[model samples]
Target: MADGKFMTAAEAVALIRDGDTVGLMGGGGGLMEATHLFEAVQARFLATRAPRNLTVVHALGIGDKKTKGMSCFAHEGLVKRVIGGHWVWSPAMQQLALENRIEAYILPGGVSSQLMREIGAGRPGLISHVGLGTVCDPRHGGGRMNEAAKDDLAEVLTLDGREWLRYKPFPIHVALVRASAADEDGNISFEHEAANLDAPSLALAARNSGGRVIVQVAERLPRGALKAREVRIPSAWVDAIVVDPAQRTSYDIPFDPAFSGELTGTARAQSEAADHARELAAAQEAFGERQAVARRAAVELFNTGKARPVINYGVGVPDAVAKLIAARNEQHRIYQTIEHGTYGGTLMDGVLFGYARNATAMLDAATQFDFYGGGGLDVAFLGFGELDEEGSVNVSRLGGVTVGPGGFIDIAQNARKVVFCGTLAAKGVKLATGDGRLRVLQQGAVRKLVKRVDQITFSGPQGVVRGQQVLYLTERASFRLTPEGVELFEIAPGVDLQRDVLDQMDFMPRLAAEIGVMDAMYFTAALAAH
Candidate 1:
């Protein structure tokens, strides 16, 4: 207890030195972030211009798309390099990566989380097939984001006559993490947080490497109050603790005992207490087009005929598919899983995506990715920002923004059947659907179907090489990928082939002699009946 010291954020941040590699912890919208610590570091840099040119590492995106989390360190000379698993939440950081002002590297979320553990255990590096044929593969680009990213962090080698990637490790000089409570001994507990994330692993990596572990927590308790089993990071691994009494569980949720499993109640009580009806109504109102796409995709899922199919849905438009499944009361028929280790239960939309309403069980994030990376999902419904003539899908970078692939590469590369979902275009696009027909009210200015994508997050050519089934679903038409290219399989009724479909695309698609119309039921009364 005496060895662990309570310190202010400024004092804790002062431990960082210039050119050091600092490890961070957090994810999008789940504000389990060390906000106070980030502010202190930012203030220190602004006031004294010290601790410049440091390398930052994180396994997840840690901001609110504003100046809240990692954006605090977005100034020049503060961060020289960044190695992250995701990048959508932090716009400033992404801009830096886009402009080549800083070196950027994006890796799979599972690999980055697991890499910390390997470093803690004194391993040479991580060896796995998680990023075999994607951009993360050394043969491709080794997870580089821009011209500034040139270091060979990954290497390709054969294992058991099969290709595998080895992601090299680097020394961690400091770790910045968040927790719910800390005892006098500096034992941390995340009893009011959503997920434990990588706090324990990050601490071990920092402490073992003779680095400092700085933790920000909500409250401080006596030594005997926190049980040994409840302590995620022991006093031995923790060096300093910073208390932010006003810390909230997330942006909207200040405190929810249920999130940390500290509260228990009847399932009926939990269900009755939820505002699912309100949330569902709002989602339906705001996601009409997405709901239509989901209805069609649901039919596709139903037709797959796989018994108890295990399905994974990505965020955004594909999320409507999960909502549709729940509305149909078909959750039991399909095993819904996510990369966050949540299996079965209602998948929440928006900022609360990583958590489930009534999760059956929760596994470590890294463990869940291992399942996905090894092709455990029967089907995956993912959103795409761009679809190319070669059938490659891009969701990572678009329109000069660097939104790294969080889990798209792993899920898309390994899923048995992938159904890419999104609108034919974005921004101001309008559509009308009713009575077994669909009509375009107005076309969007930005077309999603392009000649070539800015970046290839899901390689359609690779999927074809592996004999995987790939389908592209839109509000108007659907296409299937083959060895030759994209082939038009179905079109919506009341839509012109040349004006609404062909004219919007950059390249011509192979068409069958008899192009079929999408089942009218998808556009009309079938959705209402469900």
Candidate 2:
């Protein structure tokens, strides 16, 4: 080791004691993930059976959907409990939670990130309206995933005749965080990382609780080599440092200068063009249902004639909306923001959902949530798994699976205009699009529009109370949220209102005064043109 604070991954992980609460900092796709550190912990536990019955907490989904990130802690005896913002990325951890082998709780990603900051500052707990009336509320299972999660981590409190959800704080015994590099004196910097997630907050939470902060870095630099502004976590906060030269920017990507804002000028434009070409190709292949929905949603960006509107694109069909905007050369007309805090760039999808190529700026995840919670977004396009007659949308728990609402609640509840994009139904649904019309070849067995959702990830009634303009866009139909309920406003060219839209839904939505047909250009390759 170069110094007392510098050590191998094994040595750093050895400092973690049994039954301790470990806080991990990473988002999906292994952004800022300390893979070697997590692997060392898993290896040590398997060999010695030590560090048993640990409690793990993470603000975002951290994994490659296989054996990395939270999966390394999936061993039954290794982890006794898990409190996370999202769970779908790590199927192994989800399995553990599903089988009731571990106590599992899911909170909103923004709430989770801010709660860590509260804990670090020695606050009582996080008291906010972020999760009110949702699963995170004490009245609605209190963010508990399974029967094994019996403890009440959230409570409903009334102040000044207003209801708010209070998320209780807990001590963190160990913080496993990652950054791009660390100085010889143990100051951490995230110069090469895509996002500076909740790493600094987690480190502070552990250190203030009389615990340890172990950081994994790609390389080690001499003291003072890093600029003052580059040092995200000061040396006084970091206890141990583990250098992993092979650390990747993300799960599948080794290193990309575009992701870290290192590319600029013509280089940035060329990189973006290449990425757009590949995304355009992929979008063309899957251009039937989702593409139509995205095209309609993209049109909303120009609604109300708002110039340079700030927008957020959630995963799934909503991500396609950004690509459509780029394809039209209209990206500069809108400011794009991701939950992970990257702004204004070509957003990546799949495992790289939180990152962007040629990002304009990167804010810490907690601060980004602060902006979102304050209604900084002019519009937000999100994906939905279920839409109820009451206009509520469910994306968290679907088909007997627990896919926690990552940042859906925070963004949906605050954005001035919320547009949800998804297929009318899922599982075996097929469509054919040509000649400026769409034909549904097969109906899906699953009806996404239901009488009631499995969970209330977005409360339609609450949105109405806040006076938010909400719209639901699907392949064959479009609906707007009214004071009464969902009202159908548009249908596809080749679709029948009764058979294709109404009959497929579980309940009847209010009919618009005058229903219109969606633009035909959206159904063909002409959608790429302005």
TM-scores of the candidates are: 0.92, 0.97
Q: Mark the regions of model 1 whose C-alpha exceeds 4 Å error after superposition.
A: 1-3, 261-263, 283-287, 303-306, 525-529
lDDT of 1 by residue, 320-359 (tens): 8887777656778988987766687677777676666556
Each model's lDDT comes to 0.81, 0.88
Model 1 lDDT vs. the true structure? Answer: 0.81
For residues 339-361, what per-residue lDDT tens digits would candidate 2 score against the true structure?
88889888888888888888999
Clashing pairs in 1: none
| Model 2: residue 7 alpha-carbon error in angstroms | 0.8
Which candidate leads the pack in lDDT?
2
Cα deviation of 27, candidate 2, in Å:
1.8
